[model samples]
Target: MQLGLLYSGGKDSTLAALVLERFYDITLVTAHFGVTDEYEHARQAADAAGFEFRALELDREVAEEAVERMREDGYPRNGIQHVHEAALEAVADLDFDAIADGTRRDDRVPTVSRAQAQSLEDRHGVDYLSPLVGFGRNAVDRIVDAELDVEVGPSEEIPRADYEAELRAVLAEEHGEGAIREVFPDHDQTYVHGLRE
Candidate 1:
């Protein structure tokens, strides 16, 4: 089956694509709201990883909603969860037979509850998969260390195409950098260059 895997040019999503490639024809798909040109980073990462790549354009309205939510909550959890669910739905709307993401077991935000996953599958007639849902951070890191060429840094500095980056851009443009900084604390992030040489 052809699979559309939501990619962020990060180690988790890149590894997810690698894990699923043997079983399905995988496309590394980056979803963006046209807030920024960061999606090109994911396309480059996909090319380096030897995977087919595509960009899934998301609605700007949703980006606005997420930004507002984050501003209200003073944290990015709910806003990110909202965007993740929407991105999943957008991916499912594609022609692929299956869709996947790189959300890990311990990830606090951007999680798809079982009911939500079921609903997506039922409504879209495509399987929804999270290849790393069963893996902990330590295990994922081990695999990345052994198998992938990834650059690790703070989220603000990392060259990635994740929703957080686009969302940050939107929030900064509309509100200010202070608004986003208040919502998103300092966290380490990764950018996948490719499989390790």
Candidate 2:
């Protein structure tokens, strides 16, 4: 089966792609919200993993909507989820049997609810998979440690295709850095700097 894997060139997404490759023909799909460097990084990661790569450029309106919603809600919890759903919807037209993301068991935002997953499958005629959904942070870390070599850094420092990057940038610029802090809160954000052999 051909699977469109939503990739961000981060550890979780990259690892998910690797695992899914054993069962399906994996196509790494990275969604770019705005002018960012994530597409290139994701492409490189796909090359390193020996998987076909595709970059989907999301409409700017999607990012604008998320940002506007975040400004109104005073938090990004729901805004990011909106962006995620948009990303999944963006790939609905692709010729694939399934669409997957790296959302883990511990992920709060950008996670597809059971109802939402079912709705996608029902409406799109494609399966929705999250390989890491059953894995916690510790188990995922262990798997990454055992199976792949990777470099990690602060999420802001690492350039990967992420909705949050564009959202954070807009928030910081328009509302100041404090707005970013208020919306996202304190979290240990990390990204894969490089995927090693």
Candidate 3:
């Protein structure tokens, strides 16, 4: 089974690829927002992971539209949902049948919309296989630790929180802070606090 991995270069996503690669023809697909720093980090991860990598670029307009929709509807909101769809589309031209993600069963909870997982299976014939489904974050960390050669890269200088804050700030300026919180309520504060001046 040839599979396209929706990799973010994060440990979870990388571990997902490592697991699935055992059974499938895996190609790495990473989505970027066209920022130089983010793109470079992703590329480094891809290179280190040793998979042929493909890039999907989403610009500010796309991000804004999705964030706006997500704010109104909630998790698995239209915007975030579309990001996965766009990933599938980005790799549609490639030679793969299933697109896999790094979602663990632990991640399969009430908070994440079921529609997103169902949509992936229904629309793409792709199996949303969470190989680490039964494992929690700790287990993932342990597995990653066990595989010292996995080559997980260093933490980003600005970190994801910084990006989240930047996005939130932009959204607030464009719409309002209330709108951003409504859209991304669980925005990881580590990014926000770390990046704050």
Candidate 4:
């Protein structure tokens, strides 16, 4: 079956693609929230791993809307869910039987909710597979050692948290601190400060 692997140029997503490709005709689908280097790295990783890769630029309409809600309501709207909605929109038109991501058993399943997973499958009328669901970090290391040529280096400077924080930081730095607060006033102050630091 044809599958779409959600790639992020991280060890987990890359390794997930490695495993899934053994059983399916896999094409890597990557999304970038305006991080060009991160997007390019994922593309190169897809080439090295021998899967066709497509990069999707993340749309911020939902994110911006969520922040606006938080600003008015004094509560953080569901940011991750908003992200998933944006991702779903980006891939809504792709031709594929399934969508895959790099989630593992060790990673909190709740991090990506059942609703989110179901939405990918149910809304898109495709399977949502996580090949690494039962594998952990060691399994990933062994797979990388055995099958892939790319050296698994120190996790790129892009921490998972950096995904959202970088957007907020750039807005704060470029526009002004007040602009960020106006957009995401309820965002954890410590996170914004620490990311900038």
lDDT of each structure?
Answer: 0.93, 0.82, 0.57, 0.59
Error of 1 at 104 (Å): 0.7
Residues 28-141 of candidate 3: C-alpha lDDT, one tens digit per residue: 777655543454554566676666667666566656665666666754345655555555555554667777666666653212246766766776666656566667878876
Q: What TM-score against the true fold does each predicted structure earn? A: 0.98, 0.89, 0.64, 0.66
Candidate 1 per-residue lDDT over residues 1-197, each given as its tens digit: 99999999999999999889899999999999987899999999999999999999999999999999999999999999999899999999999999999999999978988998999999999999999999998999999999999899999889999999999999999998778888999999899888888
Off by over 4 Å in 4: 34-37, 62-85, 149-197
lDDT of 3 at 168: 53
Worst window of 10 by summed lDDT in candidate 3: 188-197
Judging by lDDT against the true structure, name the best candidate. 1
lDDT of 3: 0.57
Better model by TM-score: candidate 1 vs candidate 2: 1
**Quick one: best TM-score, which candidate?**
1
Instruction: Please report the TM-score between candidate 2 and the true structure.
Output: 0.89
Error of 3 at 70 (Å): 5.9
* Candidate 3 off by > 4 Å: 35-37, 59-61, 69-82, 85-94, 108-119, 148-197
lDDT of 4 by residue, 1-197 (tens): 89877666556676777677678898878765663345565666666556788877765555555455545654333544456556655665588888777777776421456777787677778887777888876876676566555432222233332234534554455556675555554322111001000
Better of 1 and 4 by TM-score: 1
Clashes of 3: 3
- What is the descending lDDT order? 1, 2, 4, 3
